[model samples]
Each structure stands twice: as C-alpha cells, then as structure tokens.
Target: MSALAGVALEHPVMNAAGTCKSVEEVDSFARSAVAAIVVGSITRQPRTGNTGNVYWPGRVYSINALGLPNRGLAYYGEHLPGMVERAHEAGKPLIVSVAGFDVGEYQEIAEVVADAGVDLVELNLACPNVWDGGAQKRIACFDPGQTAAICTAVGDALLARAGGDQAGRVPYGVKISPFSDPAALAELAAVLAELAGRPGGPRFVTAVNTFPNALVVDADHRPVVDVELAGMSGPALKPVGLGQVRQLRRLLPDTVDIVGVGGVGEGRDVAEYLRAGAAAVQAATAFWNRGEDPSVFGSILASWIDAGGIDPVDSAIR
Candidate 1:
C-alpha cells in the first residue's frame, strides 16, 4: 500500500483528471482495480468546451484541446457526496479535480468540493487550452507567484472549513506544467518548497500536467485541431515526465508526495516513476488507448515486482 499524506491507497495507480468525466465513468472506476478515481476538472460554472476536432491519436503520441468542459461545481456539489459514498463502499477514495480562471474562483470551487467529502483535491494549474474571453490565458503553473497565491488561498480555505485542525483538512495537490529547463524547474521547485513550509499547505505535487502546446497539420495545410496549439500526451511525453519526477524528487522534501504523470502506458512505465521517487503515478492517454480496466497494467506491475524486475532506487539497472 502507498500513502499520500495520511490517506492510504491500495495501489499507486489512479486515473488522471479529465480522463473520467461522467457518472458512468465514475461507476466504472468504482469497480476497477485503480487505487482511486479523479473526477474531471470542474469549474464554478458549466462549460461547453471548444469546438471542432479536439483529439488526434498518433502512433507515438496524442494531442488534445478539450478546453476543460464540465457540468459545473453546482452539479458536483449535489452529486459528489453520493459518489464519494459509493467509492468508499467499493474501498476506493474519490478525488476531485478543480480548475478556475483565477485564485478566487479556485478557492470557491475547492471550498465547495471539500465539503462533499472528497479524499483529495487536485488543483489544475497547467491546462494549456483554456481561453478566457476569447484570449488564451497564461498557464498558471508556469508562473510561480500565481501558483503560490492560488495554492495558499485554496489551502487556507480548506483548513478553515476543517475548523483549524491540519489533520482534519482534506489533502490537496497541484498539477503543474512540464519544465524542460533546469533553471525554470528550480524556480518552480522553490515555490513548492515555500508552500510545503506553510502550516496547512499542499501535501503533494503532481508533476508535469502536460507538455507545452504542440501543433499538428493535415495534408490540406490546415490545422488538425481548431486551436493552433494543443497539449501533447502518450509515449512521446514519458522521458520529459520522468525528468520532471526526478527533479522534484531531488528538490522537494519527502513529506511532499510526488505523483508522476504523462505518457505512462504499462507497468514498466509505472515502475520507472516509482523508482524516480514518486509516491504514485497517474495516466490518461494510456487508459484511453488501453481500456478502462486498470488491472491490465497493475497486473503487469505486480508480476514484475514479484520477479524482482524493479528496484526502487535504480529501476533501470534492475
């Protein structure tokens, strides 16, 4: 078993936010072998998302510009309690993903979701496709100041709702942008380190939300997606994600859980992240390419571990 903060997970695998977006998907996760289920990114108001082609699957990678479509926090406020109860009955924890246009919006949405008994709240600060009032806003994870402000506000709100006891507060984490530059990653790590020093700050950091925007064109010389740039996922992102996990492991204290994400498709990939010092790992494209049954990958990991194919400190050598 792996534990993040005080919550124990049966396994270290779970679905990434936005991969499981519906009641049917939630029910499916409840019955699956994944350790937990993270609901789609939710906003204060419902969103219709972007138009035109939104997803493109490739041999090595996939690109998407889904634009954070969701049914709004009000809908979740009413339904998530029951969903949480059902997930608990299945012996799984239900995590909710919250996204907002600004810090206040993040806090508001997080406060509401916290009251619904969610086991964890993931603040999505690195969505690359969000457009506000017809203009693309800067991804929050790229801005250390903004990231710190949003995390502080949301953490304080959750703590207040928990009545001043840090233990009673629901653990939360940040989904940050991928950084290939060492200096930039160092800056971001400093921000997270500061948050970790806070009395009731984030307990975990989900490394590498998605790589920077990418563009794909078709034979007719037109963009495949309506948007000029989309987020990249799948096998192409594994190396980058692995590097981010390794950097975070070296920089952040062990108290802050690191969730390695991006491009993981098999048990070997999950083991790679674990060896990089991630407490857990998450995958979206793999689930989309492979299927909803998480055990397909979990079983492979189990078999590999039993065979001593993975060593926590040096998985490559093993």
Candidate 2:
C-alpha cells in the first residue's frame, strides 16, 4: 500500500506539499477536510530560507516569494515523528516532502524518514534553488538528458534505500517541473518508464510545479525579490497546469501513475486533474486561501464522488 503508483489516499483531497505548514500549525483546520497533510519541504541541511515577505496576496490571487526554509533531516526526524503520530490519530496519512542537493542527499533523507516512520516520501525535484552552483528554479537543469539523469539517479537511490524487496514498505514519487516541449517531456517520461520497469523505481510523477518566474514591477518600477524573476502560481496557472498534466498522461505509459497538481482550488479542480489522468491530486494555493478546514474541499469532492458524477477521462481530450 506504500507504493505511490495507485494507492488510494484516505481522502481524494490532499494538501499541497509546501503550501501547508507543520501538523500543529494547521491541525484544527486540517481535521475536517484533508485526508493527508504533507509538511513543507525538508532538506538534508538546515536552512533559514529567504528573508523579507514571502507571501503577497492580491485581489483574486497571491504571490509568494518564500525561499524553501526547512528544519533539515535532524530537526525533521525530531519534529515529523510527532506530526505523523498526530495525523495517524486523525486517520490521515502523513507524507513528508523532501529535497536534497543531489541524489546521495535525497536517498539519505528518505532512508532517515522511512526509518522514523513516514507513510510516503515525495521527492521534490522542483524546489527553488536548493541545488549546488546556485542554480535557480526551472533553470536548474533544462536539458532533458540532465532531467532524466537526475531523476534516475534519485530514483535509483530511493530503490537502494528501500532495499528492493521492502520497496513496497515505503512509497516514493517525484514532483516534476513544467518543461515546455512535448519531446522533452516524452524523453523524461521514457526515463520514468525505464525505471518503473526496473527492480525498484518511482511509481508516480507529479506534474508542473509553480509556473515560470514572472517580472512584476511596482509603482516605483522596482522588481520584487532578490531574483530577476519568480514563479507564478494560483488560479491564473490552472489552464497551463491542465495542459501539462494532459500531455504527461499522453506521453507516459498507462502503467506509470501520475499525480496532478497546480492551480487547484476546489473539487472541480481535482476532477479536472483526474480527468487529465492523474491517479491523485494535490494543491497549495487553495489551502492557503481557504485555510486548513478539511471540508473546504474534501467534503465537496467526497460528495461529488458519492453522486454518479462525471468522471474525468483522457478519451475526452479529442
């Protein structure tokens, strides 16, 4: 059941990886709706993240510039055990979203958390600037070959960490960044297909992390953040997210599972991602705007599923 490939979540609605904080931070709000709460990205090393305001909400949308600040493996080991216990008390699964500078670091963290007792581990390949050489987000490694190599390296490390036969005991999946070309996506999907065929590799892929960075100038014509551009996410990115998921579904073999995430704000959004062929779905901005209240979207999705509602399908694409 730990195989993320096609495992049914306790609930269809899940909190997006970085959007929600620690269990204690949103416990009351998450009690009702979220079937699972993924703690923020934890790295191999401790990070204080970026300084300055990380969240800037607008009329119908919000902008976030928070650098990925985490307690690292040492702190996560101490903090997450308690969080997982609490989520279990509420009958919710706890997925730990983790990032590492490279493959070795990723496996190291996965092994540590698996030993500590996490239900699933989400390998965040889209984290902003956590890699070496000061590479920024999206631009970290645009070459398809590089992406495939990175994934395969990480996937292999995870398999090794899980020790093959016990791979089923710990689920592993990667959240992919949106790369424009279909050929590039197909190439990356091919790599995943190869790994999926291997002894122990990832079973699922989460598509299109935040949108490519934006250049927004204030009244004084000054740009925000220390970077030249920042990624955009929210309702505005919905269509782009849909397209990426739809394409990945088309490119990936049917055997490979996909988790659709990005610009999801409601049951309808989850339904759309499912329609695009995601085995599971997640959101960040929605939870940010609606708070952690589970019923905010979970009940709505559960109710829709209870009814003989329209099922999203790839056949509908034409």
Model 1 per-residue lDDT tens digits across residues 1-318: 677666888767788887776677788878876788889799999988888888877889988898999999888999899889888999989999899999999999999889999999999998989888989989998899999999999999999999999989998999988887899888988888888888778889898786768998889978888986999998899899999999998998777999999877777788788899888888888676665465555664565466454444544425
Measured with C-alpha atoms, the lDDT of residue 136 in candidate 2 is 56
> Judged by TM-score, which candidate is best?
1
Give lDDT tens digits, candidate 2, residues 30-125: 475665667767888877776665555444555565667777788877777788787787877778777776667777787777776777777777
Error of 2 at 118 (Å): 1.6
Locate the minimum summed-lDDT window of 10 residues in model 2: 309-318
Measured on C-alpha atoms, candidate 2 has an lDDT of: 0.66
Give the TM-score (vs. native) of candidate 2: 0.84
Q: Which candidate tops lDDT?
A: 1
- TM-score of every candidate: 0.93, 0.84
